[model samples]
Target: MKRLVAILVIILILIVLGLLSIWRLSQDMDVYVSRIDTIQQSVEQKSPDLSLIAQTRQDWENEMQLLTLFLYHSALDEMAEKWLEVELFCREGNYSAAHNTLSLLRQDWEQLYFQELPIPQNIL
Candidate 1:
């Protein structure tokens, strides 16, 4: 019947949209991961660029405004805390601690990134 067809169409559209969002978010996450990698490299060099730290955090905050629409806040909570620690360590010239925090943050980011992929483990 017409009602049944319409419902099926709507469901199909929702599924397609969900797939698109996952693909787009995964791409954005890759950018975020690379951004952190650059910061870690800079910190490893003993430069401790507070400006870069501030800029990256600012960029992340700006992006989160849109990202929040699709992501659960709980998933981001730990990374948010780690980011603050990274900023503090950089400001205090504690590159070693910053490096460690970045590693932890990287793991958190990877967990989020992989969770969205269309892998067997994630799908099954």
Candidate 2:
């Protein structure tokens, strides 16, 4: 029937839209993760640059606005806390602690990034 076909078409469109959304979000997260990796590497240097701490914070602030659209607030809150810890460590000249926090931040970002993807396991 025409009604059945119309319903199927709508459902297909919705599915496509969902997949596209996931793909776009995943790409954005990949870029953010790479930036975090760069920050981590910088923090691990012999003489870590504290300047990178401020720059990383600013980068997260800019990304958070767009990220909030597809991510949970609780996840964002946790990331913000971890980011603050990184800043604190950097300000105190604790490169080791800052490096550790950066590792945690990378893990958190990965978790959040995958959470946005439409994996079959997630759907089931």
Candidate 3:
């Protein structure tokens, strides 16, 4: 009876902790996604700036350290590839290609962000 109550209490605590973890991860990923959106907007301008593209890539590389802990490696790998494509397009003065790649990168970020949610469908 006391043992059963204790077990239930512990289980409740674990569930709360899990939910909190998901919330925190979602917030962090949201920030990254927002930043990507800002970069995307910048890239879509008439004359996209190469310097801004380089800076955004560097920012993403820095974030990868903490992001890798919560996100899947495959997602990260694909994001890295997209970043490379964006950089290449920017260097080649192909603003349209760079914008398209940035759009794909943003989509990936959004997908990863939602993947952190503790959805019942995901579990069952």
Candidate 4:
């Protein structure tokens, strides 16, 4: 009887662990799905403001020239800055502008970034 109880306890613990893992995964997936939905809605409902993002990109590119190469490694900050600009563009009734900002940011990241490229990891 003791052995059976021990086995049952172990099984219960495993079941609990499995349930927790699945719950966590579901929560993460929900966030990811919500964020995707937001992006899709923004794209479909609003237009992109290419001009604004382009201007911001140009300004950043020029500013990058003034900074030393050593600090260039801080791509995370740049990525965040560009992301915020894109979000702001989207908020200002220019989905196209946000898309443009994201495009330029992606280009900059591809060309000048080497560290783990930050791709807005927010789930929502």
Candidate lDDT scores, in order, read 0.75, 0.71, 0.69, 0.53
Task: List model 3 lDDT by residue over 3-80, tens digit each.
Answer: 999999998987776655555555566566766677677777756666766776776676665555544457767787
Question: Against the correct fold, how does model 1 do in TM-score?
Answer: 0.70
Q: Model 1, residue 12: what's the lDDT?
A: 95
Provide TM-scores for the models: 0.70, 0.63, 0.61, 0.35
Query: Which candidate wins on TM-score?
Result: 1
Error of 3 at 85 (Å): 1.3
Order the candidates by lDDT, highest first — what do you get? Answer: 1, 2, 3, 4
How many clashes in candidate 2? 0
**Where is the poorest 10-residue window by lDDT in model 2?**
115-124
Q: Note each model's CA RMSD in angstroms.
A: 3.9, 5.3, 5.9, 14.4
C-alpha lDDT of residue 20 in model 2: 58
Clashes of each: 0, 0, 0, 8
For residues 1-124, what per-residue lDDT tens digits would candidate 1 score against the true structure?
Answer: 9999999999898777666656666667767888888999999998867787777777666655555655455656666777878999988899999999999888877877776445333432
Off by over 4 Å in 4: 1-72, 112-124
